[model samples]
Target: MKSNLVHKVVGSQYPLWRTVLLIIVLILGLGQTYVSTHFYLLYNKANSQHHDVHHEYYISVTKPINTVASMSNPNANGFTNAEIKNIQNQDFVDRVGAFNPTLFRIVIEPPKGMGHQDFRTLLFLESLPNAFLDVDTTNFKWKEGDKYVPAIIPRSYLDLYNFGFAQSQGMPQVTEGMIKLFVFNLEVKGPKGSHKLQGKVVGFSDRINTLLTPESFVNWGNETLGSVSKSELPEQLLLKLKNPLSSDIGSFFEENQYEISKSDGAKAALTNLINYSSFYVWLNGIIVCALSIIILLLVVYLSIASSKTEIMQLFFLGYGVGKIALPFQKIAAIKLLMAAFISLPIGAVVAGMIVKNSAQLVPFNSAGFQLQLLLVFGALVLLICALVVLLIKVRIKRLSV
Candidate 1:
């Protein structure tokens, strides 16, 4: 058959070394492309899901405090309705919640026999919506008739007591479980009347600073026990952001003379560090793939140049340029297909290894690994094969002429 004669001619023209070199470069380019794409998707998913974490995208905003000036009018440090509206309209903000502080006075009396028999101090409680809280809120709700109140205190409070107070006073350090077991009496005093309620610590938070109770509790306390008018505005605001790295955050806060805590700033800095590192990894993989592509093209050119004389003879014998180029085109297509197929298992194994090793430091989800890898690399191999086939046809046509 005509095909058999063409194959014999083409097979003799390509040397063993050149064929081997071509296969190696194709594998190199395709494998690099697959691996890089896999990690890019992995980190991109991580970036999108990070907002769900408490300390990453949510930050508390407050005006700068002037203690002497705030004594007469505490509302001076609070945000006006206009200011709140402006922040809500900004492109970076997703949602905003205010910290509603209790308007009444409260004194906490610890359970007896805990070695602090005479410890009683005025305590302040603030409430935010349950959606903003990081802890489980099933047990955090309160009704008007409930005798017991559940509270969430800051983790830093316990750390300060254990590391600083306990160590300094030579007292025993208490754990979270122990704190939750201790019941206290909350003596709420106001112009209306004085009421005693039982309270207990239910959870701890690292994001919010003050002691927190259910929003329902705070509203009920302000209505029943608080002496102050209900017109008091909130002094602090919590903002959920769409993108924490947006320039609008710093500019808007600076222009309004608002301040964010040190912990929020640290979280933003850490996020920036991670984003930059991922970008560099993706760039390096791109460079390697590009270099491999160039090497593969060089081998193709050399193979055609060596067979130029035979191609011219075949053209003079009435064979078409298309027929003469078919064998070389088939070689490129088969090798590219081989590379694409082989890289799948290899890439999955490498990605699995990476996810396993970094599980503790970073959570990497490899959920759609095979499907995405297949679609991305399938298109890449097809594009490269079409390019290589076109290159062979053009070079052979020129040689035959």
Candidate 2:
């Protein structure tokens, strides 16, 4: 019976409590890393394409302007230099461009074949850089001898004429291409003097409103006819956001009481989702790590207690604590190292399977370089195993032989 008991005690594996806790810790470690990594990759992939994460919208400050004359520097628009700089510095904005106001007044004579009587309209013109213009500018070029000033009008004007003016006046609705062929005379007046120039519509824009001309044409027209600008700054600014759903962009506008032209109201929600998921993943890791440490301590204590008889016998036989403790230390180190080694490949395979399946659902170009993911997981495993082995060594030394 004594010999049987000795064999039974020596052959015993980890107790049920230790085994269950070890499994839980192992699962948590693998799961936390894999889940966090998947979300991280998804977030990066979403941000990388950036074809159109959000819809196109316009932003401007909202100050009181009761009347045309009540506006603060209406001729210069409401945007100040400091305000422009503040907007441009925002991380969400991809680019910002301001409208260049025509220093001249324009008198429009009715189209040649449109009406029988004398009809005229007074208007102003604004222009932006060619890159911002959506129209084909091949024929929009200019020379001193050119008769017609090529103009790219807004699509809103077409909608108005189609649904409002033409319907009310019993006139035929016109198409964009047809309108481009219709020529009208512009009596452009500036501080220098007035000149009559023929102008024609070349194309229409979906975003920009008001009459738009070439930047070169506007500069030449302003220099030749219009008086020098009273204010150097532009009257209207065009802000292009890099990410439409950015919370920073929305918050800034709200805090400043700025007006937005259009908002999809989706950016803030998406960003919040990413942030919340990240926060939860971190919280889970922290909790699991704490629990793992506690379980490790308990396991160490229970293991030492189980072998107390043999350990004490060794001490009484002229053997040192170091000699008896060495086996337990080696066991602890080997178990942890093996777990780390096994878990690394398992975690990697799980991550790969998830990414591959996700690609099938919504295809994306796989990353050619994933050294960051490998390095991060490898370093974490190395660090955790190293710390656990060191702790095991210390615990073994403290065991009373």
lDDT of 2 by residue, 318-383 (tens): 655555555555555555555556666676677677667655765555565366666665676567
Candidate 2 global TM-score: 0.52
Clashes of each: 0, 3
Give candidate 2 misplaced runs (Cα > 4 Å).
1-13, 45-77, 81-221, 225-257, 261-283, 286-290, 305-363, 368-375, 399-401
List the candidate 1 regions with Cα displacement exceeding 4 Å: 1-8, 11-51, 54-56, 162-175, 228-231, 276-280, 305-360, 363-401
Q: Clashes in model 2: which pairs?
A: 76-235, 77-235, 245-267
TM-score of each: 0.74, 0.52
Best by lDDT: 1
